[model samples]
Target chain A: MKKLFKFEFRKLLHSKSFYIIFGLGLLSIILFMILGRVMSDFVGDSSEMYNATATMLVVLPNSGIASLLGTYLVLFACSDFSQHTIKNIYARGYSRTSVYFIKYLLSLAATLTVAIFYVLFGFVFTLVLGGHVASIASYMWANLALQFLVLVGMHGMFFGVAMICNKTGVGIIVNVVGIELIFTLLNFLMQIAKIEFNILDYYLEMILANLMNSQQLTTAALVRAIVMPIVYAVGFVTAGWFVNRRREV
Target chain B: MKVMIENFQTNNVVETENLTKVYGQKTVLDHVNMHVAKGDIYGFIGKNGAGKTTLMKLLLGMAQPTEGQMKLFSNGNLNAERHRVGALIEAPAFYGNCSAVENMKRFAILAGADDNEINDILQFVGLGDVGKKHVSKFSLGMKQRLGIALAMLGKPELLILDEPINGLDPEGIKEIRDLLLRLNREQGVTVLVSSHLLDELAKITTRYGIINQGRLVEEVSATELMQRCQQKLHVITDQPAVAAKVIKKLSPKAVITANENSIDVVGITVDSAKVTKELVKNEVAVQDITFAADNMEDYFIQRMGGKA
Candidate 1:
């Protein structure tokens, strides 16, 4: 299993798509930082604007990290199918379950790596631009932890879609349209119906928003934030594994 | 029944009994019973969509058989013994953007082969100088060679190659043929290669399994096939039954088919003079005699019920 993991991770790490996505992510962050600086200047009162900019950095994980990592995982997971390289693994006696699990673990690691790079660079850029770092230190660590879970949960869903679909175009559509548009539409309908609890909040994006925007994390909210994403991660990954095991490829 | 049976030893590298594969309403492979002996270059002959690839897939555990059993290396547990076998079911599958060595290294790792052996495998497949050239940039022949290199990674005991020499030049074909021969002769590796190039397959194969419409029509050895297809004397005689009896006495193993006006004597190593003498001794009169032989293509055509 360790050998399989190392081989799979190396394949992911050396892929041209990995470098392309990583570079584009860095460039986008740089552009956002520059835009933040310009907005602060135009709004006047540098210290107040700097605090706002730092708050924006904290909130960046909510949307930016999940979508970027989700897109990458969707593409990465479907590539083996498109290229037919998965045959090599199975033909060499690796179990389909092991292959699916390793790919999931690698996707998680890739998401973490990209997220860490984004945060480190965002922090350094904020300091260089003289933005005052916000002091929500008490809950900041917990927020970051919750954000990590959200990333995992989102990637798990995308990975499952990629494996089940086994086609690049279908995977991308499921990740972008199926998850984003349909789920958001469902959430909006629930709100219009005046439902007290939005069931979609148990999913990745809603849980991420709740974690990032809530001023004081309640015990129930905290439990949901931690437990829901883990559930999503495990449930989707297990589903992907099951499908992979039965799949002919 | 003319199928080849060279080595009479009890060891069989691959054996399948009534193995079937069904896709939706279509049965792609139906009750295929195939046998491949150890150290034999078993040629799997079939036309397109004749279930050749499907059988290889079942043997490799890439797809499960709908019914029946397949034993590899004397074990029916394919998941456990599949590591001892290496296969290329169709066109070589790899990360086209990665170099040949890189692709091999990845498979080698999965195959539990030492990383250091990648270079040797690449060299063996005649892709030694393909350094750093990504597989996407490779020619069809190069891609095929790299696929072979990938299969040879762990020094597997059994090799299942599907249309391996399809896109090769004559020289490339010869090279691969020699390579397969070397592997079989020197390393004792059993090969099950499927190809439409019957002539090329005839050159190196020790045994053959002919499949048609998802059914195994025949399995033959090189020597037995040669004997079955060898030139024979066709004698037109006034008394074919009497002539046949006379010839059978001289060449007991001769395959003789007696018609009203003729007796076709096949697989017999006797001269026409001896046959005539024996017939005269039996008081059977022969009017005419002719010689004929069938090449592998003709034999295959005849076996498949086509006009040969």
Candidate 2:
């Protein structure tokens, strides 16, 4: 199993698309910084620019990390099927369960790596733009934990979808259009409806928002943010493993 | 139970008992009972979509049998013994973006092979100089050789290759054939290769299992196939009965078939001088004489009901 994990990680690191998507995530931060400078100059309000920069860093969990990781996992996971290399793995006596689990862990690790890079870039941009970093630092640890869980949940969902579809184009559509776009839209509707209870708290973006705002870090919120993503991660991976075992490849 | 023990004691590398695979309403492999012996170059012959790949997939445990059992290395535990088998089913599958050596290194790690063995196997398959060229840039024949190289890793006891020469030129086909033959001869590796090119397969295989429409029509040794496809002396005469009687008198055990206008002497080395002299002496005039030798293609066509 260690051998399989190492081999899969090597393949992921060697993939051109993985680096391309990761570069895109970093590029988005630089682009956001540039856009803030131009907007501040035009509006003659430096405070607006600082607020936008802080918002970008705050929402990096959902917009930058989750979306980019979702796209990357879709492309990376489906390559095994599209390229037919899954046969080589199975032919070597590795079970489908081990393959799926290793892939899941790899996706999580890759997402965490990219997310860290995004945070580093965000910090540098804040310093370069002359904005105080103290506001972002207070919630940084909490938000980082929340982002990690969100990524775990997101990776699990995308991994399951890609494994089930086993086609690159279909995987991309389901992850980007089906899961991300549709779930975000549903969460927006819940906000508009002004529901008393936060039923959509389990949704990835909602979890990110609540974790970013909660100052006390209560037990119930911790369960919702931490334990729920773990449940999503475990549930989706188990289902994907089951489906993958029976697939003909 | 007795039959199981008997098969286990023998040198069979692969044995399937009434194995069947069904996809939806169609049956891909129907009750396929096949045996590949140790150190035998077993050629699995079939046409396209004839369940050749399906059987290989089943033996590799890539797919489960719908109705029966498969034993590899005489063991019923497929998972434990599968590491001793290496297979390339349908096409050569590899990480296209990775270099040939990189792809091989990954497989070596999975197969528990030492990293040093990678270069040796690559050179063995004629891909030594591929260097850092990714597999996506490789030609079809080059990719096929890499696939063979991957399968040859870990020095597996059995190698199952399906249509390894599908898109290769004549030279490429000959190279693969020679490699397989050398592996079987020098390393004593049991090989089960499937191909539609009967003539190419005939040159290297020691035993053959001919499949038609998901059924194993026949399984015979190369020597037996040669005997079955032996040349016959066809004598065309106006009076075949007289020709048969005259030829029968000389060689009493000769297999003479008297047709409408010709007599076929099966499995007999007819000395033209002696047979002609005997026919002239018997007042029989031979209008035409020809040797009809059946090649592998002709035999395959005949076995498959002329479908080939």
Error of 1 at B25 (Å): 1.7
DockQ of each: 0.65, 0.55
Most TM-score-accurate candidate: 1
| Candidate 1 lDDT score at position B39 | 88
How does model 2 score by TM-score?
0.82
Q: Please give the lDDT score at residue B84 for candidate 2.
A: 91
Task: Assess every candidate by TM-score.
Answer: 0.88, 0.82
Off by over 4 Å in 2: A30-59, A120-143, A184-200, A216-223, B1-10, B232-267, B271-293
The Cα RMSD in angstroms, rounded to one decimal, for candidate 2 relative to the true structure is 5.3
Q: What C-alpha lDDT, on a 0 to 100 scale, does residue A122 get in candidate 2?
A: 74
Candidate 2 per-residue lDDT, tens place, A1-249, comes to: 898898888788778898888888778767866786688878888664565335444546434656676678878887888988888888878887888888888887878777766766676676677765445565656657676777778778778878887888888887777775676677678789986555566776567767756566677877888877878788877787888888887
